[model samples]
Every structure is written in structure tokens, then in C-alpha cells.
Target: MILSAPSKSADAPIPSFDQIPCPILVTDSAGVVQSLNQDLLLLIGSDKERWLTKSMELMFPMASRIFLHTHVWPMIFRDGQVREIRLQLLDSGGNSLPVFVNCQKTSQEGIDRFTWVLFVTIERSRFEQALLESRQRTENISTALTKSEAFIRGVFEATSEGIMVTDSDATIISVNPAFAKLTGYSQEEVIGQNARILKSDRHDADFFLATFEILQKNKIWNGEVWSQRKDGSIFLGQLSISAICDQNDVVLQYVVLCSDITERWDREQLIHQMALHDGLTGLPNRTLLMERLGQIIAKSQRDSRQIALMFLDLDGFKKVNDTLGHSIGDEVLKTVATRLSSLLRNTDTVARLGGDEFVLLLDNPENSEAMAQIGARVISIMNEPMQFDNAEAHIGVSIGIAVFKDRTSSPEALLKRADEAMYAAKAAGKNVYRFAE
Candidate 1:
């Protein structure tokens, strides 16, 4: 049999082809019309007789006619098939349709051995509307994603505190500029390197192990720590580390949040110093002196050691203040404080108990001789000349010493005895030291 089927007029082999939904037409080898589908009649907005009055090219423009006669028919004849051909079809409304057309040729026994047919995949009317909708949706999604990326980048760059991201091995993956400036490390020097490069050597290996163990177990850790900079300056910081993880809780990387507390800590220390010591003389005030003396008495009671308590008043201090103005007298007091500090051993406490009255905590004294020598040393240092404001000033200390054999719960009683001896020294002589009975 010839490789052809019956035409639409004689009931074609494919039933769906007979009820073709798209515009279809068949013609013989010489191009006379043999059959047409209902779609073809409706598409041209004309019935069979109207189409028969014109050649197929009369239905198309001149350029499309040349394309159909030259390229389209030869390819179908060579391949015995045409698939999904995209082309423009002219409608009776004089509007063009963007469409995909498919055609096939088969031999018919009585019709010059060939049948040519055409199909329209898309309706000529609604094609532009569908394409416009598709393009609009694509544009909306692209714009939204672009805005989201810009917002995220701005937030990452604008944060105040230092932030760092590191991998599982503690190698830094990304660090913001604040982190670089805080640690004195450049981005190039830090990236792809272990963050432990900033390790202050303050934390030992055990400390690291404990820290990571907590992070692994709890997924987070927050506390204070000592860390060093690239230049080896040690500083304190409040640090927090959180481990980033996958869905199964396998550690991916770490995010470190840190704040430099060094300046705050220094301020706290200055406040503490101001509260415990006199400002101008840099000598322990009574509050701190009493605390030290109490501890010393408690320790001496436990160890059966003797402790000395001395009260000293600067002689002729009021004369200096009255003659040279109170400012020069304050300078002389500071000079005397410094001299006493250099002469006293580290085991003792020297305090300025307001004005020119001072107290000394003599720790671990042996006997009356040890007390006498300690007493003599302090008096000699105080008797030396002190220079203040380019002028010579001389002063003497009348000191009274008392030994505490056990924990003296009564600071009042100790002070009373020391004061009594101090008055006795003033009465006995101006530059002498005496011990309390």
C-alpha cells in the first residue's frame, strides 16, 4: 500500500484529526482544495466557498506566501512530517497571530498521490495576552529578590558591636570591619586563619576545651574573658559564642559577639581607689585602714603573732598652713605621706586619717625592740625636710605605738590607747616616739 491514508472527505484514519480543534486544510499535489475542517472555516471568518475563491497564498501576505512555497513544503516532502512550526498566520480580522503550526503530508491513491495539510496550534486572537502575563510575573519576583539582598547587606554593615563568623576549626570565615579595628587585625590577615590568633594566652588549653564543650552541648556560651590584640595588649571583654548548626545539629560554624569592657573596667577601678584612699595624698583613708587592721588582728590571734598600731600627728602642721596658706600646707602633708610610704615595709599599712592625723598598721612585730626600731625608722623619715612649691618645709611626727597580742575586737579601745600615748609624746617632747602602756 502507498504510505497515505484516506482524506478527511473519506473519514481519515485518526478520528481526532477528523474532528480537528485547530484550523486544518488539505489540498492535492496541484494545490486544488480537497477538504477543510470546521476550524479552518471559522478561522478565516468565511465558509468553504469563500476560501475556494482564493489561492492559499491569497490567505497569507506576499512574504509568507514565498516562505510557505519555498521552505515549508519541501521540508515536509523530505521528512514526511512537520512538527511544532512556529509562524504567523493572518486572520480575517486583519490581525496577526503568534502561533505554533504543525503539518504532515501523506499519499492518497486517487489524488495525484499526495495530500498537503496545515494546522494552527494557537488561536490567532488570544496569543499576545498570554505572553504578556508570563513576562510580568517574572519581573515582579526579580525586583523583590533584589530589594531583599540590598536590605540584608545594609543591616550587616551597619551594626555597632564587633561580629565574627568562623568555621568548625575556628578559622575565621568572615569578619566585619569593627571586628578588625577592635582586634587591630586587618581583614586580609584574619580571613582564612584561626581566630585563636587573637588568643591572649590568658586562657589555657583546659579553658578552651571547657568553653567548646559548653558550646557544643548547649549551642551557646556567654561570659567575660581576657583576650589579647595583635600587639599583645591584654584587655577584658564580654563575649558570647553561638554555634551554627545544620538540621541534624551538626556544628557548621560559630558566631562570636563581643564588647570591649577595658575602659569600663578601668573606670570601675578608679572609683574603687577614690572610695578607699584620700585623693591628694594617695594614702589609704580610714575606711580601708580599718579593714586592713581588722584582718591583721584576726590573723595575729590565730597565729599568736603581735601586731602594732601607731597613731601619728604632724607637729607644727597648723603653723605651716596658717603662714603659707592652706594650699602649701596640703602640699607638705602629701610630701610627708610619700616619705612615710618609702620608709615603711610592704607589710605595713599607712593611712591619712583626715587632716594631719595618720594611722599605721604594723604587721607581725616580734618584741619591744622590734617595735622600738620600727618606731624610730618612721620618726626619722618624718623628721626630714620636705620641699613644697619651691620652698623648704620641715616637719616632725609624734607617734604612739600599741601591740595587739590577740584579735582586738575593739578598734575603739585600740584607738584610745594610741591617742593617749600620742598626747604623752606631745607632753614629753615634740620629736619623740613612745609606746602605749
Candidate 2:
């Protein structure tokens, strides 16, 4: 009996090889193509009849053919399978098309055959380029952030002014090296402490409350502040406080910048004192004396009170200067100033108007009799002998008095009136007092 091969059942479906998504080919071990799917025909834009029985190298570019001989064939023969080998094929339009080729060795009817699956790799190349670009951008951002942080830290550490950062609650969060040096407090001592730890008793509660109110409204405050160091010494500092805020306008932190200005403040005060006071006796000079007299005059007029002005010229002062030198004369004058100051009340002012000339302002002296008594006492004190450096000096004073009531006279007018009265007293015998006519 003769047996026939089983025929495919009409009811069962046969899967078409052309329906595979990837281009596929069947080849012999000699690299000649035996069959190819319709997908392969579309990929190369050619008909299957033209590719059948043709060497696979005929479809590849020169470089791809060489790579196939050197790498793909040897790997496939050694391992019976090769995967992910990239190559280019020439299409009907003569354009080079990149593809990933995977091959597996198989047997059909006891003859060795190779199956090749090729995938177009255009989208994958584009995705890989985009991934590389994204990675580079991320690296660049990280590097920039690092550099910015380093620059800020350098400024904080290197600045001469103290820098302190605190939270919204005024708890110290961080301090720079300059802050530690200025305050004499280490970072370990100040961190987590209230900012008030550095407060000196110089400012009251209202001062801090007002400062905080200004900061809340304007977001910054600048002023001079007295702060105590860890060693309990107080220093004046020019301080600036700034509020750091978030996107929602909520206060996140407070930055305090401060520099010690104690030396500068002291120097300024010294300059002011030198400008307004006499260099010899450290007493108020003519400028300050006149300013004070003006204020007193205004007050006396408002209160309907009386003020006394006395101008005195020292007698025998020039003889002392000629006999015992100007140094001894200066000592005698300083001694006379001390004795006169001792006799007056704290409210009174005595100023020297150059050599041997002095002015005294007495606030609300009782009557002309009281003014005469003060004038007599000044003359008695001046007549007493003053011993300086083992040299005895005798000097007397010629006193003139000018009294002012609630009048509209200017200070300059009252002063000139006193000057005229002084010359009248000098015309009268010296060492005597006379009242303004």
C-alpha cells in the first residue's frame, strides 16, 4: 500500500509568516538567502523573487558586509546564535537603513538553516540621544548648586562683620566665624539658644517690641545696639536685621549683621567735647556757654524769674605772668577757677573768656543784695594768696553785675551790658563789685 503525507485540515488556520512585525529571512550556511517574508520585502522595497537565492551580502553596504564576515558569522558559527548585531542595509531608494539583526541557527529537513530577524532602530537611537542629554543637564545643575553653596559659605566665613541666623521664634540657628569672634560665644554655646542671650540691659522691653514691629512691617531694621559679650563686657554695634521669607510671605528666618562701633562712637564724642569745651580747664567754652545762657534766658522769661550775669577781670595777673612766667600764671588761673566753681551751685555756669577774663551765670539769684554778696565773696576769694610750685601769687578781681528780668532783650545785648559794667568797676578802685546802671 502507498502512504501519503498528512494534509493540513481545511478547518484549521495557517499563520502567515509575512504577518510577523519584524523583517525575517531564511538562509543557508553559505550565506545565500533561500526565502524572505513580505515584511522584509517592504523593508528593502523589493519583491521576494528578486532576493531569493541571492547572497545576503548583496543586500548590505560594503562596511556592513565586512562586519558581517568578521563578527556576525564567526559568532553565529561558534555559539549557533547571535543577537543585537547592528548593521546597515541598502534599500531600493539607495538610502542606508540601520537595523538590529538577531540570528539563530536551526535545521529544516536535516539541512542547516539560519533565521535572521531585523528590527529598524531609528526610534531607539533617538531615545538614547535624549537620555544622554537629560543626564548631562542633571549633572550640570548639581555642579552649579554645589558652586553656589560654596560661594555663600566663603562670604559668611570671610566677612569682618558678624553674621547670625535665627528662626522666626528668635532661636539661634547658625552663626559664622566672625559672629563667634565678636560675641565671644562659640557656635556650640549659642546654637539653640534664644537671641536674647546676647542682650545687654541697655535696652528695655519696649525698644525690642518696637524693633520687632518695624521688622515685621518693613522686613528690615538698622540701628545702633548695645550687646553684651560672653565675658560680660558691653559693646556698641551697628546692627542690621533682615527677614527672610518664603513664597507665601511667611517669615522663615532672620539674618543679623553687626559690627562693633564702640571706638568710633567714643572718638566722635571726644571730638564733640573738644569743639564745645575749653582745652585748658575742661570747662564749657564761649559757644556752649552762650547756648546754655540762651536756654536759661528763655526759661527765666517764661517763669517770670531773674538771672544774674557777672563779668570779672583779674588784677595783678599780668605782673604775676611777667615775674613768674606764664606757666605759673596758668596754674593761678586754674586754681582760681576751681575755687570759684566750688563756691557756686551746680545750676550756675562759670566760663573763662580768654586770659584773666571770666563770666559767671547765676540762675534765679534772690536780689541785688544777694548778687552783691556773691560778688564780695568772689573778690575775697581772689584776694587770697595762691601758692603754685613754691611761688606765692596775689591777685584781685574787678566784678560787674548785670541782672535780667522778664524782658525781650537778646542774649548778646545782656552780655554787652555786663561788659560795660565791668569797665566801670575797673574804673572804680579794683577788688570791688559794681552793678549795671
Candidate 3:
């Protein structure tokens, strides 16, 4: 039978098998004795060597041995465990000892083993009858407790989310099967290791300090954590940690649960990118362009430096769309975006404001001459023919320059000035540039 001991306080240490308060025996599947705990050894009045490698039949009287062969072994083989069987054992002096036996079968390292817990019964026949009656009354409650414990153990083993239990000092005590699978580390490998072995070095000391501080204050912490596996791959985990405390509110252990969230995180980032970028050209949209312009303006004002904003309207794009269809026109726009992005410095910003309208924010351009040179380069590149499928398309761009020198100018006002200048450039000619008045 699988039995759960009494619930221990959080601060209490787990007792060793030999330190247990009851007599316990362990044997292989064939009833060959493997080990006996101290209490069992004392009850039998024998040393460890006497029982080692011996068949359990040697410890029992003839009647009990027959009962074990006929009833107990069959029950254990059929049910994997048995509870509350009355049995008689032989002590060193050849006296019969009556006991209540509970046994469970378990597999470890591919070998089946049986563990037995024995409770001594009173020798008087009247007392034994009374004790059996009392046991019958509590049997239902005991069975319920055992089933509940077994159900909990089943869940722990079967859950997909990783679970780990550690002492207050962050020493790993136990890890569930999911934890082993997720980390690529077996239970035996991580049992005594510090939990930091999973650290990915992505978070700083301050990050952990803040996490613990919040956990201390609230008794629980939940957040995203990046951890490394035994194979050295990093995974993002949505993690929660709870402190187990004693009656005096002293922490003794920590329970950590985690689920991999890397895919969810990547999806969120994709959604955010879609929100701020153009669908067609993958360039910054108007909203992102304006936000970047505002930041650059603020920085330029603080440093007493000049910044430039260029407005571009494609010259023959509508004609190409009208004749060659929107697909080829889209190809031409994407090609233009790539060329424009390649020509600019990494610090400069190039954005598409929908349709054939584009904008550029240049940080601390040396002078209007340098701005004109960039505008000329843009016009020259846009004039080149773009090949798409079996057709070729030609497009040109009219450019307008707006210089930001006054700290008082806002992003909207600067954009308006550049827009007006773009109209001026279109009025002068289709493929030329103009400065804002």
C-alpha cells in the first residue's frame, strides 16, 4: 500500500529511511531481501548482514509464509500494492510476532521493488479484537487519505508544466518529470544542485533582487524569465514562485512552476511590429515616423543642432499603377523603399506615409548643401527603371526640404511646411526638389 506520512511543517526536514518511526523492509520483486531499516532490524533482533540477500520467507513462520505465497503475492502482483494484511514474523528467539503489514510495489531504474511498513499489534487476543474493531471504524478515512495522496502524486508526474521544489537556500530538492523534460536534465543530475544552474545570464543581479524583494513582501512572484537548458538553448518561461512558510511565518522552501512562453512572446512581438510598420513596404508608418521626428527634434533642440525633414511624392507612380496593374506598382514601391533605406545612415529615419508618399528625418545634417546632395541622390535612384516579371516600370520622385532650427517648431508644423514645399517642387517640374519658404 502507498501511505502518506503526516504533513510536515515547512521548516521541518525530511527524515531518512532509517530515521523513520516505523519498521520498514525493502525487497526485490522475487521477495529477496534488499535492505531493512533500523526499526525493523531492532524488532527482529538481528544485524543488517543476517537479512541481506535472504528470501523474506526465512523471516516468517510456516503459516504466514504460506499465506504470503497464496494471497499477498498475488494481490501485490495484481494491484501493485496491498494494505492492512495480518501477518506473523519470527523474532531471533523463535517467538511469533503479530503485525499489520502495508506493502507497495515501485519501479526504479527498470527494476521492480517492494517496500513494506509493519505495525506491531498487541499480543492479547481481547486487545487485538478491540484494536481490529477500531481500525475497521477508521479504515474508510485512511483509504480516502491514501487515494487523495496518490491522486496528487499522479498529477505531479503527469502535468506538462514544469515544477520544482527547493529549500529556502535555493537548493533543489525535487523536480517533476516535466521539469526534467523541459530542462534536458534528469532528476538524479539536479537533485542537489543550486537552482542557478538554469540561469541564462539574461537578467542582471538587480532583476533577481527585485523579484525576491517582491516575493518576500507578497509571498509569491509571477513574471517572464529566460532560462537555459542543459543543452545550452535558451527558453522564455512564464514562471511563478511561492514561498512555503511555517507557523511562525519563517520561510523553509520554495515551489516554482513554469511554462514555456517563447512562442507567445514572438507572436506578441510580431503583432507590435505590424502595428508600427507599413504593410506593403515594411517601412515605418506615419505614426512611427511622427514619433521619431518628435524625438529627433527634441534632441536637436537640446544640443543646439539643426535637423532636416524631407518630403517625397513619387512622380509617375500613378501612371504605372494605371497601365501595368497594382502588383507591378507594389513591386516598384518595395524596390524604392529598399533603395532609400540602403542610402541613408543607420541614425537617419526613412518611412512610408501611405500610397506614394514618403518621409525622411535626417539628424544634424551639415548644411542645406548636404541636404540637397541627398535629395539629388534620391531623385537619381528613383529615376532608374525597375524590372518586375516580364514588364519594366519607370518612376521619379519630387523632393521638398524643411530644416528644423527653431525649438518652437512642432512635428505637425514642420510636416506641413515640407508638404507645401513638395507641392512647390511638383509645380516647378515633375522630378525636381524645392526648399520650404
Candidate 4:
């Protein structure tokens, strides 16, 4: 069949394609109809008036619509011509008419236009069906991928573990909701920022280096980390890092997962303190006192220095408790502990053995004169008057000093000798001190 254009100049007016004996249609680059030959309209059983200004896509069969858009349109735009492309068109009666078409883009009076020539055929139904099935498969796969992405995004945002994704340089690219919540930063605040913004000073360079070394070795690393909040407050967290890489084993991004463990760490510290401290006065109890005495005795033997263990018992303390109740007696014991701690060096240890009884360990006490002077100072402080909630009270103490110069005596034996000397002090006078012979 032949397709021709209309007159271009006044002297040689060309005949229009309507007089041609072929089915042809013309359109703009955007697929909007410009004109069509009568034979073409007749072949599709449609009138020119009804089809003139509509998009060419409107004439394609429902199943072939996607193929026309995704394949035929891109082919025309890229190559500017398409040859023998199989397509389906809907007739005026709404029935499919399969045809092979050739389209070419041309310019008419400086306006871009596409001319399509179609040849209606009865064969090639199988090829059309195959194309349609392939398009359907692509659409189905796309839908499934979209749903999977939505499910994964929901879990990432909803989880309580803080999740962060960073570039290879440790610059944060994205963060989940829990990450923002944990670090007290909004996603907008942290994006493009270095992950170091959340780092606390508690970790040294070696600590971070070791962590990165673990990641390099195992491709994943997890450990305790100290992180800082947006408000500059410090917190402890359990951080896990993973190196996300491409299939070629090239590092691309890092994924970090963290959980705040500050509360748990604080509870552990409190438990440790409770195990070694007297609950009433917050001083070392018998267990910690024994440990300290053992350490001191070992040091004294190595350094050839004398260690003094002073056992002090408050004289006439029961009378105060009997008259004023145990609450006031507890206050007195706390006060005594405070006074003894204040008088000693930091290297020394003062502990509360039990009610109205305290033990002081002094290292390198110099001589027995110094030991006696310390004992007398303790007695003088204990004899001072104490005021408790509008009640004036007086108490006294008797101290026994046991000096250890050699490793002959154990901690228990030294404590026993100090206790015997304390009894001697109490027997000699109510408010005096004695030394173990």
C-alpha cells in the first residue's frame, strides 16, 4: 500500500494520504492523534471524527496497553523508527485486531510527527500471547518486591534495638526510629554526620581500634560501648556492628545495632557495693575489712613496715541505747565512723565490725608512740558530747592497739590480740586505751 503527504507549495500541491490506497495514521511525538487516512479508519471500523484528538494508546487492546507503553513507545523515542512490531488494536466493535506495524518520526512544517503504517494479519496470535504473559510476569514480580520492601521497612522502624546505617567512612546515611530515640537525635540531625557524634569519652583510641579490628576479622563485632546523647549526657550501651559488603567482598556500608544497658550496669554496681559494705553506716563490713587486712599484712611483710590494727569498743554505749532507743544509737555509730575515717590517711581502712564496734588499720605506724597517740586521739574524740535530735548525750571508747612487724601472726590472730588488749583497756579504766604485749 502507498502513503503520501498533502501539498507543500502552492505551485505543486501534493495529494493528501486520504486518497492513498493504504491504512495509515499520523500523530505527534506525544502519541496524540494528528490525522489518519480514511482507509485506516475504515480498517479499524472507526470514523475520523471519533478518533482524531485522542491518544494513540486509547486504541490499543487492554492487554497490549502496557507493552505499547513500555516497549513500543521507548523504541520509537530511542530509535525514532520501529519496524514490524506486533501489536493489538481494538476495533470500533471492541474486538482485538492483531497487526504488524512500522512507525517513523518525521517533521512537517517544523512540527514533529510520527507516521504509523499497519498491516492487518490473521497469524501471530501466539507471539502476542507470549508478550502479554511476559508483561504480566514483570508486573507481578514488581508488586511482590514492593510488598517485601514495605514489610522490611516496618520491622526496621518498629524494633526496639537502635539501628543505624552508615557509609564506609562512618558517616551516617540513615537511621531507624529506635536509633533516633536512643541517641536523642532526630534522623535529620544525624544524617550526614559522623557516627562519632554519639561517641562518649569513656572509650580510648585503643578501644575503638580493637573494635574495628574485630569487625575486620569476623565481619561482625559486638561489645559494650559508651555513647553520648544529644544533651551531652553519657550512657552505656551494647553495640553490635556489621560490615555490609557487595558480592565482590568490597565494603560498602556498615550497619550498627545498639541497646541501652545503663540501668543494668548501675544495678550491678549497687549489688557489688551491697556485698562489701555495711548497710547502716555505708562503711566496709567484715568481709571487705578482712580483705583489706590481708592486703595490708602482705604489703607490710614485703616493705618491712609495721601495721597497726586498732580494735575500738564504745564504753557505756548500752546505757545510751537503753535510754534513747536504737535509732539514736545508730546515729552515734555513724558519727563515730565518720570521725575515724576523717582522722586516717587514705591508704588506711576503717570498718564497722558490728554494733558499737569499729576497726581501724594503719600502715607504717612509725612506732608504738605514734600508735598510742592515735589510740588516745580516738578515745578523746569518742568521749566528746554528742547531740541527737534535741537530746544531749556523752559516750566513751576503749581502744586496743596491736602492731604487726613480722609475718608470724595471721589476720585472725592479730584481731584476737587487739581484742584482748581492748578488754584490758576497759578493765583498767572506762575511757582509756592499751597496747597488746
TM-score of 2: 0.76
Estimate the TM-score for candidate 1: 0.62
Of the candidates shown, which would achieve the greatest lDDT relative to the real structure?
3
**TM-score winner among the candidates?**
2
- For model 2, state the Cα shift of residue 228 in Å: 1.0
Candidate 4 matches the true fold with a TM-score of 0.64
List the pairs of residues colliding in candidate 1: none
lDDT of 2 by residue, 23-65 (tens): 8888999899988888888868777888888998888899999
Error of 4 at 126 (Å): 18
Model 3 C-alpha lDDT per residue in residues 243-301, reported as the tens digit of each score: 99999888999999999898999999999899899999999999999998889887876
For candidate 4, the lDDT comes to 0.87
lDDT of 1 at 306: 73
Per-residue alpha-carbon lDDT of candidate 4 for residues 1-437, written as tens digits (9 for 90 to 100): 13344556869755568866666888888888888888778767767888888888787887677887888889999998999988887777887888888999987689888988877765667676788899999999999999999998998989999999999899999999998999999999999999999999998999999999889778899899999999999889898899998897677999999999999999999998999999999999988988989998888767877888999999888988998888888888888988889899998889989988899989788898988899889988887888887776689998888887558779888888888999999999868889998
Query: If scored against the real structure, what TM-score would every candidate get?
Result: 0.62, 0.76, 0.64, 0.64
C-alpha RMSD values across all candidates: 8.2, 5.8, 20.7, 12.4
lDDT of 1 by residue, 1-437 (tens): 12243576654464454465666666655445656667666666677876663566555666666876787768777886567665666877976555565665665554442343445545543656677777788788788878988886676566766788999889999887777878888888899998888888778899888998999999999987788888899888788999999999999999998879999989999999999999989999998988888777777667877778889998989988888888889888888888778877898988999989988888887788987887788778877777665677777888888777436446667877887888888888866778898
> Which stretches of model 4 miss by more than 4 angstroms?
1-149, 246-250, 298-305, 406-410
RMSD of 4: 12.4
Q: Which segments of candidate 2 are over 4 A away from where they belong?
A: 1-135, 297-308, 364-369, 403-413, 433-437
User: All models: lDDT?
Assistant: 0.77, 0.89, 0.90, 0.87
